[model samples]
Structures are given as C-alpha cells and as structure tokens.
Target: MRATSIILPALVTALFLPATSPALAQMAPPPVTDDVNLSLQVEDWVKAETARVILVVDLAGQAGGVNRADLLKTAAAIADRTDWRVIAMDKVSDSAGLDRWRAMLETRLPEGRLAGLAERAKRASKPGQQVRIAAVRFEPTLQEMEAARSALRVKLYARIKDEIALLQQTFPDRRYRVQSLRFNENSGGYRDAAPPPPPPFIPPPEIQMIGDPIRTEVIEEVAPANESGSGQEDKMIVQAMVSLGAFAGPTQ
Candidate 1:
C-alpha cells in the first residue's frame, strides 16, 4: 500500500507535466470571440501628436461582465495612455433601453463627425452583433499621410541603424542605395489627363567593369539637335552605357 501511494503520486505528477509536441508548441492562441464589444479612446497625447495608436478591447462572455459602468471604467483605463478616440458598445433588447443607451453615447462623443458615428451605433442591432469603433484624424491630402509614414520610417530607421551597420560590416562587399523619382503634370491642351511617361532608364556606373580581360563597351546613337531649340536639348540624346570585362570576381 505504501509503494502504491508513492507510485500513484509520481504517476499523477508525470501525467500533469507539460506535454511536448512540435505542432502544439507552434500553434497560436485562439482568436477573440465574435460577440465581443469593441471600443476606442482617443488620448490627449495622441490627438496632439502625429502617429495614431488604436486600442481594441473585447467584452464578451464572462471574461468580463457586461455592465455599463464596468465597461466605461475599462475604457477609461485604456484612454489614460493617450489622447485618442474611443468606440463603445452597449446591448439593448428594445426601444426603451436603446434610447437611454444612445443618450449616454451622445454625452461621450465629441461634436461633429464623431457624433455621426454615435448615431450609427445607436441604430445598429445589438444583443447578438458585436460593436466596433475606430478613431482616425482627418487629413486632406495623401501627402499628409505619407509625411506621417515617413516620420515613422525615420524613427524606425534610427532605432535599427546599429543592426544595419553590423550587417554591412559582416558583408563588406555589398552595396545598397535608395532611389526615388517624382512626375508632375501642368495643364496644357488635352481635356482628359494622360498617364505619365515611362521613366528614363539609367545605366549603372562603369567602374564595376574594371579588372576583366575581354572588354566590351555599349554605344547608343543620338538624334540631331534643332538650331531653334536650346543646346540643353542635345544632352537628352546621350544614352547610358555599361562596359563588361572578362576578369573573374569573387561571388557575392
């Protein structure tokens, strides 16, 4: 009986120890429930600053109770981090409770377009469908969004520059460059705007061809220049060329 007790406890402990399976170790957590309510809170900092950070919260099942006060407190806790927008959801069965719930939302939502979102939430069916809200600043042009994204890129680049430098040291022969071009059109004659012309191809530098035995050069024909046009027009006909040599170089 004493041996049985000791063996039984050891067997139970071994059984409860974590199982090792390669497949189970790689699996991700289950997705959030479909009936979860979602809300957004715009922090003061986020409203004033550039980049936007959104918080997604789930209020479904008993993971958290479905009380309004509790939900509001949960939302407030999330909003304390930044000055951003908030989206909230409340479930109502009939018209009586819905009117009261909508009135509360009106008090929370800022005036103007945000109020419109609140109105949408009021009319949305509840009880079953999960509510979702998003907060984003209004920008007039694509340029503004691009500027924000560029700023973020710069910050990210700064943070990882050390790693990039280390990689460059590890691979000394490699070279990297960033190239960008822009095209603009001024109003002329055509009623319908035509697509921008294809970009001019620029050949790589000729220095790369050094040390080869058998040499080759690329030559391009040019068009004659008109006397009436500026001499600057002649430069456009100078075609780019690349020279290759027979010398073997180290493989990258």
Candidate 2:
C-alpha cells in the first residue's frame, strides 16, 4: 500500500491565511467619548470713548453638576482688567437660554450704534483688501480650562499693547495713551449720569473803538456748546473673548 500525506482542515485554513493578518489576533479598540465643549470668536465694536470687552458664554455638552456660577465668577475675574471693560455678561446652558439672551441683547443694543459700527467697519476696510477679524475655537477638557484661561490672559495683555500701538499710530500729532478702563454693569445707571451743567452762556465781549468813526459790526465767533449726550441707552458692547466649553463659536 502506497503511503499518502493527509492534511487536516485547520492546517489547510492556516496555509491560506495571510502572513501579516490582523483580523485573526487583534480586538477592536473601544469608542472614544468627547466631553469638551468650547468655542471662541472675535467681536469688535467701537464704544463711545474706547473699545469695550464683553463675554457671552454657553456651557453646552458639559457634564451635569458643574458650578456655573463659579464659572461666571472665574470669567469675571479674568475679564475684570483695567485695559478692557466687560460691557455685558451672560451665561446660558441651553438653546432657550441662548434665545432669551439674543432677544435681550437685540432690545438693549441701539440700532444707531450698530449702524455706526457698520459704517466704521466699511471705512476701515481697504478698497481692494478685506479686513478679516481674527477668531479661534477650541474644545478643551476640564483640565485644559486652566490652560485656556492662561492663553486668554496673554491675549488680553496683547490686546492692551495693540490698542496702545493703534492709538500712537493713528494719532501721531496728538499724544495718546492707553488708560485703564472700568466697566459699569448697570446700563440704566450709566445713561442716567446727569450731563454737566451747561457753561453759563457768556455774552460775547463787545469792543468799542472811539478812534475809528466807521461803524463796523464786530461779529464774535463763539465756540459751540459741547454735546454731553452719551451714546444710545443700554447699548450692549460685544468684545473678543473665549468660550468655556465645546460650544459652537459665534459666526460673523
């Protein structure tokens, strides 16, 4: 009897398998869960006398039991700087809250001031070149919040420096300095500050020349009264600031 070689079924399968096969040995990795909720955008608007800084924040997709008030306090601390003013602050957790804030802002901000901002933005843009505002977005973890805060602090310092440079560059003839600006949270109160009592309207001085017989009417040029009227009442000034969560950044 002739001796014949016999191959087992397992041996036949192993012979067909690729030498570099991963499907046979590797287990799939688990799905990743993203918890970060954060975003940022540039908000530039000219205030009555200076550039104001404001923050509108939303902590969306974050875990429950987060201290929102503490977050606001932290934000206030970061924004409470002499270089910039936080004209308005709001924190929302849901879409309804966001809607409410938007409605409130729309009513509070002045239409005329917004128009003026539009004009300024138009004028600032070069004829052919467009002025692009700088904006950034991030989704940082709880641990990364501190890093984000540090980055924001650095940005604020840079903004102060840039504002000073802008003043100097724009007004070379007039000596200008960047002063510390304080924010007044009470919008109604800010508008109610009584205007300085108008300077006692002084009668123009009349000069009578006895020697000159020719009767010449002396037209006195009196300077116009300073308009003490402030900007629109309760106009919310938006500024460039960072968002705290993985929230969607504001669009242009």
Q: Write the per-residue lDDT of candidate 1 for residues 1-252, one digit (tens) a residue.
A: 888988998877665655464443344332321121112111111121232222223333332335555544544443333333333333323433332121011112222223233233334424532222322222123454345445444444443444345545765654322222122222122324556874653444411111113433221111222111121100001111211112223323
Candidate 1: how many backbone clashes? Answer: 15
Model 1 TM-score, 2 decimals: 0.17
Error of 1 at 166 (Å): 1.3
- What do the candidate models score in CA lDDT, each in turn? 0.31, 0.31
Q: Which candidate number would show the highest TM-score if scored against the true structure?
A: 2
TM-scores, all candidates, are 0.17, 0.18
Model 1, position 240, has a per-residue lDDT of 13
Q: Which stretches of candidate 2 lie over 4 Å from their true place?
A: 1-143, 181-252
Worst 10 residues of 2 by lDDT: 99-108
